[model samples]
Target chain A: MPYISTKTNIVITKEKETTIKEKLGKAIELIPGKSEHWLMLSFEDNASMYFQGKSDSGIAFVEVKLFGSASSSAYDKLTAAITDILKEELELAPDKVYVKYEEVSNWGYNGNNF
Target chain B: MPYISTKTNIVITKEKETTIKEKLGKAIELIPGKSEHWLMLSFEDNASMYFQGKSDSGIAFVEVKLFGSASSSAYDKLTAAITDILKEELELAPDKVYVKYEEVSNWGYNGNNF
Candidate 1:
């Protein structure tokens, strides 16, 4: 399964947890995996700041860890999808929501691959 | 050499770029590498939102990709240092700045292994 984590640092209400979780859940479900994987996520508020003369609308420091099957294309698509989702859901500019994807192999699964 | 990248989504003044780059420059220099590696980073404004009930001071979606020497202790320290620096430099609350760290192996370097 794809162990996914949708971490964000933004101002959110307690009521918004469900919405955020739901969106992340859907995003994780899109990846190829067949098991109950751990999904860790948290949010931060007002962590992002703007810089002048930049191409990105919203830029973020993203680090994701997943293990199951791996594909660069899927990785790329997921990056775009997750970034897009965050942008739309959070109403963030493009350069604001940066997504960095990581894929661990079966061996990299912390001895879980016996 | 550790190919490191420190991506941020915070408002950075041109004056701040020099300071930001200085901090990041120290960080990258700490890691071991021979040739110059790619340090790609950008900033965003407000991609983080609070969830009310979270332990993390600053929750961030941090994704880092580095390839050079391998050491989890250094990684851990690097994480803590970078996070701490961001917190102190920006004078942001503990939960505002998030740092994601990634390390790629020689093999993961797209056949960079000679």
Candidate 2:
């Protein structure tokens, strides 16, 4: 299972959120052993986030968690894809985006650990 | 900085949410290199979550990310504290809760990478 969550200071419309979900669904394909079918994406707009001690600026915090391991190269691609997608869709700067990855040893679903 | 984000299917009231956040802020102190001062917590109640091919059940997805490394023992303590707090505050079971941790080398804030 793979879950991608993004929290941004910029507000997003419903249509844009859908577009972003779709784009992230496709972008995640770059990483092996991940698919949109089992993908979960969460977007939070107008978050209480600060940059350089200020909150007026737009920033994005992206968290990516997967069941298995991925190469740094894969993370690089994923970050680029997500940054590009957010920039194009929400005008968020790549420099202002932070993407963190976690390779979880255990994940639970359907009442059982996976 | 340390960020804790939780997604659960159960509905949480504002008072309980505040309690949970405050509890988590204290619980995170168990881990070295983390403090409540720079802690960020987000809670999403009534989330669309599925377990064992079902969505009606109560389940929690907790994601924790920090700037530096933390020991597995530290994680174990964090898990127990979080589970206990969540169970007490939201009445969520420990078995249905999933906690994932990430040690990020790169984090950005205030228009600069940290």
For residues A1-114, write the lDDT of model 1, one tens digit per residue.
344443344555666656766667666655666223456665554443322323234434444566545566555555666666666666655544445545566533355672
lDDT of each residue in B12-113, candidate 2, tens digit only: 899999999889989999899788998998988876454333445577888888887777678778878888887788778776677777778899988998
Residues A1-114 of candidate 2: C-alpha lDDT, one tens digit per residue:
787878888898877877887888888888997777667666678889998888877899998889888999999999999999999999988889999997886454433345
* TM-score versus the correct structure, for each prediction: 0.47, 0.60
TM-score of chain A of each: 0.64, 0.96
Name the fnat for model 1.
0.04
| Model 1 ranges with Cα > 4 A deviation | A6-9, A34-38, A48-58, A106-114, B1-22, B25-101, B104-114
